[model samples]
Target: MFAALSEKHEHKKVLPDLEGAENGVVMRFAPNPSGPLHIGHARAAALNDAYIKQYGGRYILRIEDTDPKRVDPEAYEMVVEDLKWLSLAITDTVTQSDRLHLYYALCTQLIERNGAYVCTCDNEQFKVLKNKKIACPCRDQSLETNLVLWDKMLTHGFKEGEASVRIKTDLNNPDPAMRDFPAFRILDAPAHPKVIAHVYPLMNFSVVADDHLLGVTHVIRGKDHIANTRRQRYIYDHFGWKVPVYRHYGRMGIEGVVLSTSQMRLGINDGTYTGWDDIRLGTLRALARRGISPDAVKNAMLAIGIGDTDISFSWDNLYSENKKIVDPVANRYFFVPDPVTARIEGAQPHTAHAMLHPSDASRGTRTLEFTGTVLIPKNEVLPEVTMLRLKDLFNVKISWDNGMPTFTYAGDSLADARAAKAHIVQWLPAQATVPCTILTQEGEMSGACEPAVRSELGKVIQFERVGFVKIDGVGDDGVVAYFTHK
Candidate 1:
């Protein structure tokens, strides 16, 4: 798999042509609606979308909800929403539950051809025979008897765990998991949540059948499904169907973040996490809430390509990519955390101007009328500093009288300030300041920002030397912004 990385890297801006492209490329993203999509699933969706767009082919969104025991009806919509959020325009949508009868019909055909059989082996008994590499007694039953048992399975003739329709494979196959795998099994629907059928096709069987029926020319999925691909090949060969081109990508993980849906669901239930969108979580919803752009997520995943070597990255890696994209557009703002009052002596009221974005002057400027008093970050005050430049304003000399620090006009010349090695600090006129709250991954931070921040609600802005933040809302009391990344 890693051999293709060099070719992919060579054409990073273009999606590589899939094998058998002459048939008109078609791809599908099949997601199980068990939980909200995490970053891993997002990568798969993005790759499929990229390929379809590159080839001008069809894309399908297949909801794999066959496992009724784990299906969540609401998650069906959530998957669609997540794909839309990522800007993937799906050509069609499908639900496996709606096609249960098709799967049943296929199973019957396989049983009639002796490609599969209804097995009554209990768990322990099956394990013993499986370890011995011997066929179970049910495997030799007459085709008519197996057909009757299959019908019984559909009508709840056998209880859950008592019967399953297993696809026939070499009993002595080196890989034990590939030996006579179960294609469909009985589920006690009454004990399950919203199960549509007592008999449901397993993932291996359902996926293979659907892929062939849907005319998917390329199947892009995680390398972890390599075993599944081998198991599915049996079904394809039995039906004499063409196997779609398979491209498997390695698992991409964010360092220090757990992407387990089970653990996250448990956390939500136990109040360890507020919800799926909690800042500490890795769900697409959580990343969106933190102001991470969908483009950033897509670009980051695309850069990794479809290699089988697992990749581990850090928050900084994603933030660095986002910063490059957002820095040129995010307007600048002044925010003073733990604000301290400072009075400038020998200073007259003057209007100060700062560009909204340093790189894009066309964005215009933010204007503020300065009074003598201003608010500066309290923690930024340096006892050793004798002079500092109020950024985009005038230079000021610092002095302490009776334990109170004061500022005096030094000069308005930038050249002189630079010669004096004065530190530049951001400040907001006390009267023009508005209360602001910044919600960070750590916690909520209260501060004062320029009044200009009030009108930019829902826009991303850089807080001078702090970080980028998306203004979530504004009110008479203050502005609420979510920290994006530094």
Candidate 2:
């Protein structure tokens, strides 16, 4: 499915090659398993996968599950599911929790070479020194003393927040965050979900170490991480290791949507959201539930490309892209929203044939029994309307008598209706119609649709003049569908 969509965009644009990647390219998408994969995360994943496919290189799915406080085992599986849904072919998988020993060993090596030191400064003390643009007192600690403190951190001799190991960087650097940043921090082992190590390596230290050890030749991340890249470079320089080629794209966000994991967690706990898959949320699961195709997401992100300028887009942009993909395949059906029953005078019981798809006649047709009584959308019935054409059926002269709609056969030829400028409206045989509920972004809409919709469960269909919708399921009472887009 994804391969077909990717081919559509192949000729639209060309992506630049990674600098110094002529030897070979190995890219990794390391996501923290604190929450489900959201739209912003999808952009990164898709871009990396595209590069891997284009260059015929390896792609790795690395779970950055080191953060004990926020990590959820279920979220790890959800991330993998989302990647597979995006059709990302991950050649390797690695979980950081299983590599605690490797990080500790590297921490020891850094301390032994005086490249890092353990800082025991309290929060207030460090803030005071940081505000003064001066190095903390621990920066002058001897290599032997720092190593002893580091061992204590690993041995549980110090409590959480009591100490942390800091990498040696320029104290007078313009960016204070880059000055002696924390390499390893003590976590409450009893509170962690997986690993019980009290000392956990921070992202700055862990990612650099894993990238080199895991043979990641190219690193693609958001431009917001430019500072972290500079800090990681110092680590590579200290160890005399070659740094991976870095490609940082500008941050992309959906307008009016917040993708913050912390905020989402709070909303779920506070009952503002049902879960990560809530339709209002931006998580990939949420998008999937709303009938948004993974191919649509990939193509949209590919169009954005890698740039330094921040990009913000409205949901309409996504809908437009999705419409192009679904329009050709989705079958058409008559759906009357908030319908009103009207009796057709001088009408005969006839069988109407509607093409399953306007463009693809090979899909065949649907049969509808046209009885005297029919259901028409309440909104489409205009007060001044003299004539209306039942889409793919016939024209009817409409009249309002005693505030009730009365329909009389006008003609069967579409040419006459088109010449009369008659409104094209959708209608369903009242007795043969089936109940339907459409779940939209705003709220749920109740209506009656052609009985043919019931059999289209798990299929996407166009509701004639209405928007595209996916039939989610069918129960004894009604058929339920999710609105994709117009």
Candidate 3:
């Protein structure tokens, strides 16, 4: 799938060949309103936005809300919100629900012309003949009978399998989807007020007819929709309607990480994840939580290089790319989690000074006080001995016994400790001790500690000898931190 998307997308910049190419271009970004938008949707939205800006055309955001079984008003609203948050400007007037009359009119025309009919077959019957070529029982129903039943659907109620208006396409065809295809099914969709009269298909035929009405010249989406394109092509052929140019791209998949909406919901419900923003997942919240910028995603897509073919990418490449962009600007801070405090043996107390961003000084510098002792996360490393790093600070001297050692200010003051070329510096105070909260991947951890040297809030900084830290927020208790390593 990735290969196919690559080859076709290589020439994506070129104008697609279509019947109305002379009239100008009108492409549609039609995503189903099933769940909150994910990274995959973001890419498609980005491509659509870019296309409209580059080409002489309009990009229509058509809510394929035709799938009633899976629609959620919250998810639907979020789709728009997420796209807009990513800096996508979409026209507000384009939604499939707004044009339901067109879909119904087409179904009515097909039924009257013997191109469609009402099917009385239930799921069991349909399944039995799914593989075998079977003619629907109501295919030959009088147009008057179908019209009356259709009215019943609109005015009263439609029972399950009571009637389905199927397009009278080739019944002998091998493709089960197109074999006597059911164009509309009676649905009690919650998003739309429960109306008994309307029947909808599985998105294929509906999009084909509606795109013509809305003047959509092109269609770009995931490869999963390619088969639907084939079915839609058949409908267009039957109606003698012009088909839109289609470009399918590889569905973005994170390496070794199968993050889906279902997985996310399950994790949240089971207490395994904080919420949709869990860093391990791919939702917008997760990206924001991980401190990944929106531009990072867009640039990554560009760097990965789009194609109308399927391509599998390793996560390391993305990680490396992000690291390159962040290395120069990330501020330096001191963060020690599950902290264990140590005092520099009899060192004079003084304030520490450090640059926020060691490589890029424009961010300015911050002051931290090393009252004499420093705090460090109690991990595999022992904090009670020599050879300690102020993290982003220089190495310090320590006085040790058989195994344990008292702290010594072998390194510079807080400022001097961080003034060197090192990448991280953690502040330990020689002053009073206080209870501290440690941030970990699993959750918040608690411990006792002294002031750790840090520059600013909501910035990415490395502990001189500790782990990476993200300042969640500052409070009366202490600053909230999240550890980031890989």
Candidate 4:
């Protein structure tokens, strides 16, 4: 079964080689501190970490936190924690907020080199002219005048949106929006979490300055950033800096969960979501809480590779990868949801010993003592099904007395049970059951589980007829667990 499950993901595709990697590659995973990193954000991170691991190099973690309105103060730590959970190592960490001075110096130099200008034109009016392929009046301002305007932008001489710095690109470029784009802007409201500045550099400008300054050799990001990459390249050419090798994979469309960080934060604020690790959200915190290992995530991502074609995130592929990693060691147990007790007639007290693992005998067995009664899931009982085999125990024929279910003991031979077409089901003795509540994506399911389940706390285990789950808590009330996918 496991072999067939794994064969589905065996594709002939392999990851393409990184250009100029022989010169000691230096890669970075730069994420905006808006919210916790979602699974959609892991592709870039995992690929960069993989390259760094393959070819020894510096892996930098840059927190792009320049947009104050979009920034979440708590997300700084959350981003780091998420990456740590993904096991991506960083040789150095840089916060863009701390390096505003660097961007300012470079902006000033770009003005001096005639690579940029301070545009005082209204945004809408400039767009009208730009769409017509006409340069705004401020685009031709002298270097000295532009420098003075830039100083005003820094010293509150220019109020928010009154003036901005625009990088000088080909005005005749096919894409009008790409012509002389805004590199820096003034925004004085909603004080930034880390820095106190009215003027801030946009993504393209800041990314170019930081990547060049930090000596980043490769930039691996989604194809959605293709326009941004093109804009950044103009900056690199203007300053005559070596542009890094670029590899842009297609957008990863993850289905069946919310991946938008902003939407998740809104849900969390409105009480629609419990937290970052709410199990239904696509954040890494959610995956970790449900016992999905970092290696499984990484392996699943690597299998997808850095392909340019758009792809959806496959939950089946991830579950298959995870099952391969967790199946061999996950102990087996019995749990009954919405349990119903069945009295057994003509049956003697017996001890049933089941293997901890189906094939690993050395791991030993769990001894369950039964006294002519067993608890089974209510859903498994049916009027038409007469005989049922309580797995690893004797077979019993279902009967009704006083409108309540009863079981009459039959022969214990496995072959006889098969001949009777008795459906095997997981059952637990009433004497040795523990209350269990599993937190699933849909909701919580309460039931009775075998006592041995308590010993598997803080580990992943499979219930005999149900899916795998991670034991999260054991308290006076009951055992609390998070249900992982089958």
lDDT of 2 by residue, 98-135 (tens): 89899999989988887899999997889778767898
The lDDT ranking, best first, is 4, 2, 1, 3
- Measured by TM-score, how close is model 3 to the native structure? 0.80
Candidate 1 runs further than 4 Å off: 1-16, 190-195, 401-403
Candidate 3 residue spans exceeding 4 A from truth: 1-24, 142-145, 188-198, 255-258, 269-272, 305-310, 377-395, 411-425, 430-469, 483-486
- The 0-to-1 C-alpha lDDT of every candidate, in the order given, reads 0.85, 0.85, 0.63, 0.90
| Model 2 residue 73 CA deviation in Å | 2.4
**Model 4 ranges off by over 4 Å:** 1-13, 400-404
CA error at residue 34 for candidate 1, angstroms: 1.9
State the displacement of the C-alpha of residue 33, model 4, in Å, after optimal TM-score superposition: 0.4
Q: Give me the candidate number with maximum lDDT.
A: 4
- lDDT per residue as tens, model 4, 1-486: 656765774653456889899867899999999999888878889999888877779999999998999899999999999999998868999999999999999999999999999999999999998888998999889989999999989999988989999999998999975899999999989999898989999999999999999999998999988999999989999899999999999988888788888889889999999899888999998998899988788888998889899998899999988987888789999889999988889999989999999967889999989897789988878877788999988898888666566789987889988998888888999887999999998899999898888888889999877889999998878899999977
C-alpha root-mean-square deviation, each candidate? 4.3, 2.5, 6.3, 2.5
Superposed by TM-score, candidate 4 places the C-alpha of residue 358 at a distance from the truth, in angstroms, of 1.4
Assess the local accuracy of residue 70 in candidate 4 as a C-alpha lDDT between 0 and 100.
86
Q: Whole-model lDDT, candidate 3?
A: 0.63
